[model samples]
Target: MKSATQDKRVFTEQETSHYIGMSRSFLRQSRMEGLRKNRTQAPPFIKIGRAVRYLKEDLDQWLDSHRKMHQLPHEGGAHV
Candidate 1:
């Protein structure tokens, strides 16, 4: 069986928030902030008429782009 996320190529704001583990308000705020800054602060999205949609591929890429493989050293110089 396919998950709901896997079944859709595009998602609404609410579905996108659930899929990406972010709050709807945060996503909305990001878009607004991005617009003010003339840059994107959130995952790429599509705007159709008065609706917004996020592509599954863009979401996956966005998550991957934020990946951190190396751990930063602590201020105390301890691994923990």
Candidate 2:
């Protein structure tokens, strides 16, 4: 059987920030806010000593939930 560490994936703060196109400070702020929404103490995350790592799947879901779709000027045929 594979070890737990082998099964688990980890990403550095910089890597995650670059992937999400956000500043490292912003990511730290979000985490500091306690991810306040879930009933059972927000989403699960991995922490390596003092450094924190986030799962790609969790980040993707968060992005999808916060995504916004705007209609184009002519695509939706809006009268102006």
Candidate 3:
């Protein structure tokens, strides 16, 4: 059995990068882009001094918001 405290999903920058299969720099880039695009309304995050942490739920929601669906191939052919 998992304790409620242990079950809480809080991750550091490195953990988040690993979880998302992206480099730490890429995560920073994404964070910058999010800031540039005023994505505060998109997801919630915590900024502690020089370190930035993210909740799994917020990251999941952010990914869902940025997800691209129904993108057709450049060949311009429909998949039947």
Candidate 4:
């Protein structure tokens, strides 16, 4: 079996923000707060020196976990 990191698609902070449809600052704040609170509810990321990156597979899983499948359209569920 291959490790999760192996063959993963890495994205820069800017790219991740765009891919996730969130602001870069929001991503940074989420990471900072998650680290400060030692919480695991946020999406996973990697920090190398002064740079940060997110894995495409990880982001997909995170988004899936947060997805709302039963909510009405007006209940703030994503419109598809």
Candidate with maximal TM-score: 1
| Top-scoring candidate (lDDT) | 1
Better of 2 and 4 by lDDT: 4
Q: On residues 47-70, what C-alpha lDDT tens digit does candidate 2 reach at each position? A: 888878878677667667656697
Of 1 and 2, which scores higher on TM-score? 1
What are the models' TM-scores?
0.79, 0.58, 0.59, 0.68
RMSD to the true structure for each prediction, in A, is 3.0, 7.8, 5.0, 7.4
Pairs that collide in candidate 1 are none
Superposition TM-score, candidate 3 onto the true structure: 0.59
Q: Which residue pairs does candidate 2 place in steric collision?
A: none
How far does residue 71 in candidate 4 sit from its true spot (Å)?
A: 1.9
Question: Per-residue CA lDDT of candidate 3, range 1-80, in tens?
Answer: 85453355988887776666668777777667765554333245589898788898887877788777987466866668
User: Over the stretch 1-80, how does candidate 4's per-residue lDDT look in tens digits?
Assistant: 96444455998887787777788888878777774545445579988898888989999998888787785557656669
The ten-residue window of minimal lDDT in model 3 covers 35-44
**What C-alpha lDDT values do all the predictions have?**
0.87, 0.64, 0.69, 0.77
* lDDT score for candidate 1 against the true structure: 0.87
Stretches > 4 Å off in candidate 4: 1-8, 35-41, 73-80
lDDT of 1 by residue, 1-80 (tens): 87877789999999899988999998999987775555447889999999999999999999888788997666866654
Candidate 1, superposed: residue stretches over 4 Å from native: 35-40, 74-80
